[model samples]
Target: MAHPYVLLSAAVSLDGFLDDTGPERLLLSGPGDFDRVDEVRAGCDAILVGAGTLRTDNPRLLVNSAERRANRVAAGLPEYPLKVTVSASGNLDPDARFWHTGGAKTVYTTDRGAERLRGRLPGEVAVVALGPEVEWRAVLAHLGDVEGVRRLMVEGGGQVHTQLLRQGLADELQLAVAPLFVGEAEAPRMFGPGAYPPGRMRLLETRPVGDVVLMRYVPVAPGTGRLASAADRRWLAEACELAALCPPSRTAFSVGAVIVAADGTELARAYSREGGDPVVHAEEAALAKLDPADPRLAAATVYSSLEPCARRASRPAPCARLILEAGVRRVVTAWREPDTFVTAADGSGVLASEGVEVVVLPEYEERAKAPNAHLSPPPGRS
Candidate 1:
C-alpha cells in the first residue's frame, strides 16, 4: 500500500530527555528552531501528534507565521495544515486548543476509542478506527489513500517516535538538541527502550539554530520478509534514478541495481550497459564487483529498478540465476519484466521458486519505466 512520507520531528535535551518531570511542559527548542519548525509545518500536508503530546502540550500545531500560511494558500493548499492525533484509549479533552485552532482535524484510534470520540470531539474532526488496535501502517495508508496526504509530519511525545522508528515506518528524523540536560531519570525521553532498525542512520545535514543544533537523518536498512521499510523505498528510488544513467539502448532495457548488506551498507551499484559493455546487465555488473564468497551476500538484498531477467540470450546465465548463484536471498524491484524485450519472462517467479523473497513496490514503477518510455509498457500496465 502507498503511504505518506513520514518525518519524525522532535527536540531533545543534551542528555536525550524530551522533558523534565514537572507539571509544565518543557521548552527544549529556542525561538529560531521554533520558526524553522513552523516552516516545516507549512510545507507538510498534515501534522500529527500522539494523544500524550496533545494532553501534555495542548498545542495548536498550526503554521504560526501568517506569511507562510498565505504562501500555502497561494499554492492551492489550506491556510493551515491538517492537525492529526493518535490515541488508543480515546480519552481526550475536547477543549484542547488542537481542536479549536486547526483548519481540519483527524483522530486515528481503536474501534472502541472511535466510538467514544465520535460525538465528543467537534463535528469537523474525523475519527477513524483501525480495528481493536491502532496500527501505524493502517494510519499511514489511510492518510495517503483516503486523506490524500503525501507528506506527514509527526511531532511526537516519546512513545509515538519510538513506535514509528521501531516499526521501520519513519523516512526522516529531524532533531534539535538543546544544550541543557534534564537530570531526572524518570523524565520523558525522545526514544524509549526498544529494538530499532539495525545500523546507524545516514546523517543528511547538521546546522545551528540559535543555541540548539538541528540534525537531519534518514534510515538505510532494508526491511525483513514481505514488509517494506522506509529505507527500502529510499534505495529503490536511488535505483530508479540510476536507471536514467544507463546508455540509451533500443535492443535492451535501461535498468539499475544496488547490492546492500543487512546492516545498511551498500556493497555495490551498477547500471545496465556500464563500462562500455553493451550486454552487461545491471544486476550482473553489480554482482561482478563483489566477491562471490563475501559473507554479506548471504543476508544482502538486491534492489533493482527493473526485475532481473529470467531468460537472456546475451549471457550463459540470466540475472536472476546470477543473483541465486551469488547467495542472495532477497530482492526488491520497482517494475516487473515487461514483454518489450522478452515475452513471458518471469524473473520474480524464478526467484520465488528458489525460496528467495521478492518485494515489489509498484509506487516507483513509473520512475523505473521513465528511461524506457519509448518502449511499450507491460500488457496490463501503462
Candidate 2:
C-alpha cells in the first residue's frame, strides 16, 4: 500500500486565483519561476493532473531542458517523468497534447469508464480501473507498486488539489505567488471548498524567485510526502515516550526507535537497554527483529527519538550504518544527538551523506530531550 511522495505544485495570483477569467490562458508564473518548476518536474518520478486540466491546458508537461533530460538519462531514469491523469467519466480527447507528448501516459478512471477509454486511447497508454469511482489512494498504490514511482508531482486544476488536500494525501505544497490580482469570481482558484486537514500546514521554506515568491508547506497531518507524515510524527512521539521506559544509563543517552514501512505500518519498535543489552542502540535493536531479506526494508522509514549514533564504542556498527545496511531510505528524528557522549557526533550528516532522506522535526525536540536531562554536561567544564 506504499504510495509515492506527493507534492502539490501550483502558481497563483496575489488574490489566490489560479488564473484570470479571460479567454486566453493566463500566465501566473514568470520565466524564472517556470524554470524552477521544470527542475521540480525533472526530480519527480511522475506528474499527475486532473482530466479538467488535460482538457483546458492541453499541456505537453515535458522537461524542456535538454541538459536536465540528459542528467536523468545518466541517472538511469527516463527523459521525462510519467504523465498521469484521473477522470470519473473517462471522457477525453485522444488528440490532446497530454496524451502524445509525455514519456509514458496513464489514465485512472472508474471501472465503467475504463471500458469506454480503452478503445479510445492509443494502445501505448495504460488504462487502470480503480473500483466504481476514481480513488486517489488506489491510484497512488498502483503508481508506487506497478509503475515504480517514488516521487509524484501533482499539477493542479482546483478540484484535484482540493481532493488531495481534503483527503490528507499531499505531503508538500509549493506555491508560487505572482504579484498580480485576478479578481474575477469565475476564474479558477488554487483550491475549492472542502474540509481541509486541521491545524496549520508547517511552512518549510520561503524564497524569492524573480518577481514571484516561492513558499513551501508540509502537511501537518501527513498521509504521504517527502517529509514525515502525521503517522510518522505520531510514531516519533511514541519513540520519545519509549525513551522514558529505558533503564537510565549514566554513560549513554536513552533513546527509542521505530521502523515503519512505506505504507505507514510499524515494522518494529525498540528502546535502549532492550532485552538487557545496554550497549545496543535503539535503532539497532529495532532492526534486529526484522529479517535481513525483507523487501519492505528498502521503502521503510526509521523514526528515532534522538539522532542515530554516528560513532559508538558499545557496538561495532553505529545506528546510522545499521540503518543504511538495512536499506531504510528515510529517517525522521525529534532531536539531534548532542555531544555529551561523543564530541562532534553528527548522525544526521552521516545519513544524508549516504543518500538517506533525513528529516528533523524540531517541534518535538524538548520532548525528546526530557528523558536525558540528567545527562546534560555541567554548566562549565571542570
Candidate 3:
C-alpha cells in the first residue's frame, strides 16, 4: 500500500536529550532553526506529533510565518498543514492549543479510544479508529490513501520517533543538534534503545542553522520478507528513473534494474539497451557486472522497474532464470509484464514458486510503465 513520505524531525541537545527535566518545556531550537522548521511545516501536507508531546509541550504546531502561509495558499494548498496526533488511549485534552489553532485536525486512535473521543473533540476534528490497536502502518496508510497526504512531517515525543524508525517506516530524519547539554538522566531523549533497521543511514546533508547544526539522513536498508521499507521505495524510484535512459525500444519493454547488498550498499545498476547491446536485459547487464560467486549476491536484493521476463526469445536464458542462477532470493519490482510481447507471462509467479521473496509495489507501476507507453495499445483499444 502507498503511504506518505514520512520525515521524522527533531531537535536534540549535545547529550542527546530532547528536553531537560524541568518545570517548563526546554527550548532546544534557536530562533533561526525555529523559522526553518516553520518553512518545512508550511511545505508539508500535514504535521504530526504523539499524544505525549501534545500534552507536555501544548504546542499549536503552526507555520508561524505569514508569508509562508500565503505561499502555501497561492500554491493551491491549505493555508496551514493539517494537524495530526495519535493517542491509543484517547486521552487528549479537548481545549489544548493543538485542537483550536490548526487548519484541520485528525486523531488516529484505537476503537476504544474513538468511543471516548467521538463527542469530546470539536465537530470539525476527524477521529479515525484503526481497529483494536493503533498500528503505525495503518495510520500512515490512512494518511496517504484517505487524507491524500503525500508528504507528512512527524514532530515527536521520543516514543513515536522510536516506533517509526524501528518499524523501517521513516524515509528521512532531520535533526537539529543544539550546543547545550541537558545533563539530567531522566530527561527525554530523541530515540529510545531498541532494534533499529540494520546499517548506517545515508547522510544527505549537514548545515549550520544559527547555534545548531542540522543534519539530514535517509534509511538505506532493504526490508526483510515481503514488507517494503522506505529504502525499498527509494531504490525502486531510482530504477524507474533509469528506465528513461534506455534506447527507445519498439519490440521490447524498456526496463531498469539495481542490485543492492543487505548492508545497504548498491552492488550494481543498469538499464535496458545499455552499451548499445540490443538483446541485453537490465537485470542481465547489472548481474554481468558482478561476480557470480560474490558473497554479497547471496544476501542482495534485485530491484527492477518491470518484472523479470519469464520467457524471451532474444536471450537463451530469461531474467528470472538468470536471477535464480545468480543466487538472489529477494526481488522487488514495480510493474507486472503486460501481454504486449508475451502472453500470460508470469515472472513473479515463477520467482515465488522457487521460494524467492517477490514484492510488487503498485504505486510505482505508472512510472515503470511510462517509458513503455508507446508500446501499449491505444486508449480505445484493448
User: Superposing all C-alpha atoms, what RMSD in Å does each candidate have to the true structure?
Assistant: 1.9, 14.2, 1.1
Model 3, stretches more than 4 Å misplaced? 380-382
Q: Candidates' lDDT values, in order?
A: 0.94, 0.87, 0.95
lDDT of 2 by residue, 319-368 (tens): 99999999988888989987787999999999999898888877678899
Candidate 3 has what TM-score?
0.98
lDDT of 3 by residue, 57-175 (tens): 99999999999999999999999999999999999999999989969999999999999998999999999999999999999999999999999999998999999998989999999
Q: Each candidate's TM vs. the true structure? A: 0.98, 0.64, 0.98
Task: Spell out the clash pairs found in candidate 1.
Answer: none
- For candidate 1, what is the total of clashing residue pairs? 0
- After the best TM-score superposition of candidate 3, give how far the Cα of residue 26 lies from its true spot, in angstroms: 1.3
Q: Could you tell me how far off, in angstroms, the CA of residue 123 lies in candidate 1 after the best superposition?
A: 0.5
Name the lDDT of candidate 3: 0.95
In order of TM-score, best first, we have 3, 1, 2
Superposed Cα deviation of residue 347, candidate 2 (Å): 29
